[model samples]
Target: MDTSASSSQVAAAAVAVAMALLVPILSAAAGGDGWEDAHATFYGDETGGETMQGACGYGDLFQQGYGLETTALSVALFNEGWSCGGCYELLCHDSTYCAPGGATVRVTATNLCPANYSKPNENWCNPPLRHFDLSKPMFLRLVTDFRAGIIPVTYRRVPCAKRGGIRFEMKGNQWWVGVLVFNVAGAGDVKAMAVKGSQDGQWADMSRNWGQIWNGDKRHVGQGLSFRVVASDGRALVLDDVVPPAWAFGQSFEASGQF
Candidate 1:
């Protein structure tokens, strides 16, 4: 339903290769052998009102197909905002409100659970503390009681399992290009991005602007587009001619395959 991306930033994306093989190297596993301790709370109602927009730069969550299966990560797990789009599996733990032997919920990291310095000790999202601020629906799936407010939980990183191909939404103007990368699979978090225009056939390196958005300096109007995307684990995907020559800013494009 929607789109955006990252850098591997502050440096150039020097590993991009055009016409590379389709092979995707298995990502280095970030998931742990056992669950890690964490805490969770719910935000927004069942309609997911407040959960729609986020710090991840993602647009309408439902329109982007993220729906309610999304969460805001504590600063510790947010990886300085690069963790946007990463997937996590969570299970209720050691809480009376937990659903008995319930299946774990898998959610994407779509926002940041900011720490309140004024209430440092009371802030679960403070640095060095792993926490999840989940959508009300997602949190209720784990806890039997919505009134519990917060619940102890365990979680682990997991390969994202997105349906269909990865999506890209073009943002910004002709002077600069901002792309929002979403619906990613595999390592979920993008490490680097490069774009090419049919007219020039030259790749322009993009830097992590913020959240899941990447920015580049070149202008490629009225040209077919290709993309080079690298995941956090070093795997890469090359999408050739995914956007037509007539593509315009704000239009979303889907590549043929995923990483």
Candidate 2:
């Protein structure tokens, strides 16, 4: 028997099993309901730009952009954008930096804080897992002083609240149909989407292009669009006949229900 090769295979299998075990623990740490202790710092204006966009395909939340509030999470909190669009309520606990009453603010996860993005000492996600790099305006809302650079915070995930109902943006034409979902409420991020054409009477799975967009090549024009959205938490919502038969490019349709 090749003892060395057998040992190598066993080592590889052990590593794989270890990785599988770590996944659930990490996921729970990132997405669990329990409030977690974390650190917070602010970005934008003081750092440089007023306008910014995130890897999750969202524009700036501070000034004029997509009109959504923005919050950048540490690499740990970002979870590779799996936490995109998710809302979080953060409460400041540092008596020196934060007010005595412990002010709280709710913000949406819009971006990732990579290691190279900031100074080595300021890299929040490196060793410590839970961290938030909030927008300057957001951070100020929870603290009494702007001079204090970072503060201790307790944060928990919350359902997103959108002003309008869920909006569907059409990108493709008759032959190929591409739709971008927006203003998702509960669970925020989309895991999967299925589209049904009025004529076909069958559900067709749409491929995730990235972020909130999904596409499938099928003649769907002149056919009313029905959508089934699966949120990141696996909760599914079906909006029957959400898109009208005369749907046009660049037009957005609102669904009666949000996910």
For residues 140-243, what per-residue lDDT tens digits would candidate 1 score against the true structure?
Answer: 89887899898888787889988889999888885887889999999999989999989899988889999989985446777888889999999999999988
**Segments of candidate 1 deviating more than 4 angstroms:** 1-32
lDDT of 2 by residue, 9-92 (tens): 999999999999776444433544476789888887544255266666554343322342467788777776667778898877
Alpha-carbon RMSD, candidate 1: 16.2
lDDT of 1: 0.84
Give the worst 10-residue stretch by lDDT in candidate 1: 21-30
Residue pairs clashing, model 1: 4-180, 4-181, 5-181, 5-212
List runs of model 2 lying over 4 Å from the truth: 1-33, 45-52, 59-68, 117-121, 126-128, 172-177
Model 2 scores worst on lDDT over the 10 consecutive residues at 59-68
Query: Would you give me the overall lDDT of model 2?
Result: 0.75
Clashing pairs in 2: none
